[model samples]
Target: MTTSPLSWLPLPSSTDRAEDEPASESDDQALDPVQLAALHRGRDAGEAAAAWVRSLSGRQENEDHALALEHAAAGIERASHQEVIPGGEGQLAEELRYALGADVLLGATHTGTVPDLAAGERMPLVAVCALAAAMPSCVLGDLPRELTLLAAELDAATAAGRAATTATGLAG
Candidate 1:
C-alpha cells in the first residue's frame, strides 16, 4: 500500500496502539503553555503556506467573509461578550474597533512613534482594501481565506464607527 504524505509511516508494523493510555479530561484541560505556543507557531507556518498558494491564484475563490463577521459578532453576543451596548451588535462593533485600534497602536509602539498618534491613523481600511484589490488574480485567490478574515475584521471596525455615529445622531 502506498503511504500518503500526511500518513504516519506504517508505525514500524509492530507497535500496539491499545497499550497507550487515553488522556483524561482533566489532563487535557491542564495544557502547558509551551505546547500551546508550538501549536500557534504551526498555525503561523500554515499562514505562510497559504500565502505561497495565494501567489499562484487565478480567478476569485473568496469566502463569504461578511457572513463570518456576522457570525463572530453573534457568537460574542451569545457569549455575553459585551463592551458598551450592554447586550447587542453595538457591543460587538465596539469590540471589533478596539481590536483594530490595538493593531495600529502595536505598530506605533514598535516603530518608536508613540509620541505621534498621527502615525497610528495612517493604515486605514480604504488604503488596505485598495491595495488588496490591486494585487494579481493568483495572489488574490491564494489568499481567499486571509482576505475573508481581514474583511470580517474590517466589518467589525466599520460597525464600530457606525455605532459611534449613531450615538452622536450623525448616522441618521
Candidate 2:
C-alpha cells in the first residue's frame, strides 16, 4: 500500500490525554487579566442564565413571566450600552445588544409568544441563534479574532442578565 502523506507523524499517545497530569510551566502562566476578567463575567452570566432557564422549564407561562422576560431583556440592553470598559475593551458589552435583540426575535418565533417564556429563559435561545448571524460578518470581513471573542462574551452576559433577573437566590 502507498504511504499517506500524514503517516510520517506519530499519533498522540494515551498519556497525552491524561487529566491527572500536572499542568506544564507554559500552561501555568496567567492569561491577560482583562481577558480573564471578561471571560469570568461571561461564563458567570451564561451559567446563571442557563440555570434560570432550567428552573422555569416546567412552569406555566403567566403575566409575571411576560413581565419578567421583558424586564430582563431591557436590563440586558441597558447593561450592554452602559457597562463600558477602558480602551473600549468591554467586549462582552459590545456584542450583547445585538445578540439580545436577535434573541428576543428568535425567542418569540420559537415560543409563539415572548411572554410565554420566563424572563431568564428567553435570551439564551436568541443568543444561540444570533451566533450564526454574527460569526459570518466577522469571518467574512476578516475581522480580528478579538471581535469574535467579544461577540461570544456578549452572549454570556445576556445569559447572566437573564438568570440574575429570574433566579431566586443568585445576584448575577
Candidate 3:
C-alpha cells in the first residue's frame, strides 16, 4: 500500500463530539487586532453588498446579468462565512475589497454621489482603491470573467475619480 505524504497530518474525525465538550481556547487567541478588524470589515462589507446586490438584481434590464449578479452575491456571502477558518480572514478581505470596489462603482454610476455614506461606511470603498493603487499591476486575463469585468469597471472609476479631483483642483 502506498502512503500519501499528507497521510501523516491529523484529519478531523467524522464522529460527532458531545455537546458538553469544551471548545478550543486557542481559536480566539490566534487572531491579532489587524486580522480581527479585517475579518469584521470583510463580513460587514459582504453582508451590505449582498443586500445591495439582491435589491439591484430585481431592477436589472437584462435577466442574464441579473442572474449573474445574484450568483456573485451568494458567492460573496459564502466567502464571508470563512472567517472561522485559519487564513480565511485574509481571503475574505481580498475578496470583499474587489467586490466592494465593483459595488461602489456600480452604485456611483447608477446614482450620483452618495452623500449619505458615513465615514465608516465609506472607508472600505476608499481602502479598496488605495490598496489597488499600492499593489502590483494586475493581469486581468488571469482572473475569471466576472472578476475581470469588475476590475475593468474599477479601473474606469479610478480614472474618473482622478479626473474629477483634477477638475476640482483637489489633485496636488
Candidate 4:
C-alpha cells in the first residue's frame, strides 16, 4: 500500500479515543484552574470595590453605590466565562495596559493623588478592570463610562480632602 502523508503520525490508541471526542456543553461549563482563579479574583475585587466606595463619606448609606457594585460583580462573573481568542496577543496587551491605567487611577484615590499604593492594595482594582476589559463592547456598554465618572469623583474628593487636611495642619 502507498504510504499516506499522515502515516508518519502515531494514531490514537483505544484509551486515547476518549480524549479526541468533543466535550459536551456541561463539560465546557466546568471551569479549569485558570478560570477558577479568575472567578475568585473577581469576587475579591468586587468586595474591595464595594468596601472602598463605602469608606467614602456619605456613600455608606447610598443605595445607588450598592446597586452599581452589584452590577459590576455580575458583569465580572459573566466576563469570566468568555473564552480568550487565540492569536490576539496585540489585543490582549492593549487591554492589559488599559486595565492597569484605569486601576492605577482608581487606586490613586486611596493614596491621595499618588498611585503609589502597594501591589497588593491595587491588585483587586486591576483584576476587576482586566475582567471588565475582557467583556465584549456590546455587553460592556456604559460600564467603562460609569467607572470613569466614578474615578473622577473619587479622585476629586480625595484631593479636596488632602487640601483640607493640609490647611488645617498649617493653621494649627
Candidate 5:
C-alpha cells in the first residue's frame, strides 16, 4: 500500500552494472591532460614505492627518519600546489597530500565501496610510508626494516612524481 516510484523498478543485475558502469567512479570524470598526467604520476608513484619497499635490505637504523618524512612531505606539498595544471587536484593527489601532511596512511584503512585496481598495491604502501617516515609513537613499535621500507617508498614516490610532472610540462 506504501508503494511509491521505487516499487515499480526492477533491481539491476551484476551483468547490467558490469556493462553500463565504469569499474570505479573516478573513471566517469572527464580529466584534462594535466589531471590525467598527475593521476598517472600518483599511480606510478605508488607502484614504485611498493617496489622499493619490496626490495629493501632490512630495517633502517635510528638515523634521521624525521628528516626523510619531512622531505617527502615537502615534495608532496609542492606537487599539490603546482599551478601549471588547470583542472585542479584529483582525488588521489588530495588524499596523498593530506596523508603526507598528517604523517599518516589513511589509505591503508580506507574501505571504499568501489574497488580500484589503479590503487591496488601502491596506495596502501604509499600511506604506510606517510606514517612510517615519521616514526611516531604508534610506528615506533614496528620493525626497523618496516621504517626503512617506508622511507624508501616515499623517496621513490617523490622521484616518480618529479618525473611525471616534468613529462606533463607542469614542472617548474
Candidate 6:
C-alpha cells in the first residue's frame, strides 16, 4: 500500500466526523492531497464562519457532501485566481463555502504517505492567510484581527493533527 506521508496529522475525532453518513466517492476523484489539506484546514474556518453567520441571524446545519466537493473546491479556487472573486454570499454561497472549507480541513488535517517532508511539516501561516484572503468574502470579510485569529487557529489545528499522528508512530 502506498502510504501518504501525511499520516502524521491527527485523524479527526469521531465526534468531528459525520458518522451515519454514507460514503460518497464525491470529490475523491479530482483531489491530489494538497487541496484536501486545505479543505480540512478550511473546515474549522467554516465552523467559525457558520457561528458568525448564525450570530447574524443565519442558521444552517451542514450536510455531508453527496458528490464532487473537492473538485469543486479546486475549481473555485482556480476561478478565484483567474478572476476577482465576487462580492456577497447568499445561502448558496455559504453552503459552497462550507463544502470547500470542509474539504480543506480534511486535506489539512492529514499528510502521511510522502517520504518527502517528514511528519512535523506545516503549511506556513502566510500561505494560509493568502488563501483565506482569496476567499470570496474579503470584500465584506471580517477585519484584520479576525483574519489573523483564523490563521492562528489553522496553524494550531494542523499542529495538533501532526502531534496526534506522531504520538502514535503511524504518521509516516
Query: Which stretches in model 1 have alpha-carbon errors above 4 Å?
Result: 1-141
lDDT pick, better of 2 and 6: 2
Q: Which clashing pairs does model 5 show?
A: 59-144, 59-145
Over the stretch 132-152, how does candidate 4's per-residue lDDT look in tens digits?
A: 444323113342343334334
What would the TM-score be for candidate 2 when compared with the true structure?
Answer: 0.31
- lDDT minimum window of 10 residues, candidate 4: 1-10
Worst 10 residues of 6 by lDDT: 52-61
lDDT of 3 by residue, 37-136 (tens): 4334443444554554454455555555455446545644544423223322223345545543555424434443332222332343353343333221
Candidate 6 residues 1-172, lDDT tens each? 1211122223655243254544443313343454444434444453443322222121111222212233333433322321122233311244444434534323322332211222433232123323443543332444233334544564454455345445645443
Runs of candidate 4 with Cα error greater than 4 angstroms are 1-59, 82-123, 135-172
Of 4 and 6, which scores higher on TM-score? Answer: 6
User: lDDT of all predictions, in order shown?
Assistant: 0.28, 0.40, 0.39, 0.35, 0.35, 0.34
Give lDDT: candidate 2, residue 61: 56
The Cα error of candidate 2 at residue 158, in Å, is 5.0
Model 1, residue pairs in steric clash: 54-142, 57-138
User: RMSD in Å for candidate 4, one decimal?
Assistant: 16.9
Rank by TM-score, highest first: 3, 2, 6, 5, 4, 1
Q: What TM-scores do the predictions have?
A: 0.23, 0.31, 0.35, 0.26, 0.27, 0.30
lDDT of 5 by residue, 6-96 (tens): 1121234212233443354333445445434433333334345433332221122222332333434443433322211222221234444
Top of the candidates by lDDT: 2
- Model 6 lDDT, residue 91, Cα: 19
Name the runs in model 6 displaced over 4 angstroms: 1-138
lDDT of candidate model 1 versus the reference: 0.28
Per-residue accuracy of model 1 over 45-76 as CA lDDT, tens digit each: 32332232222121112222222223333322
Better of 1 and 2 by TM-score: 2
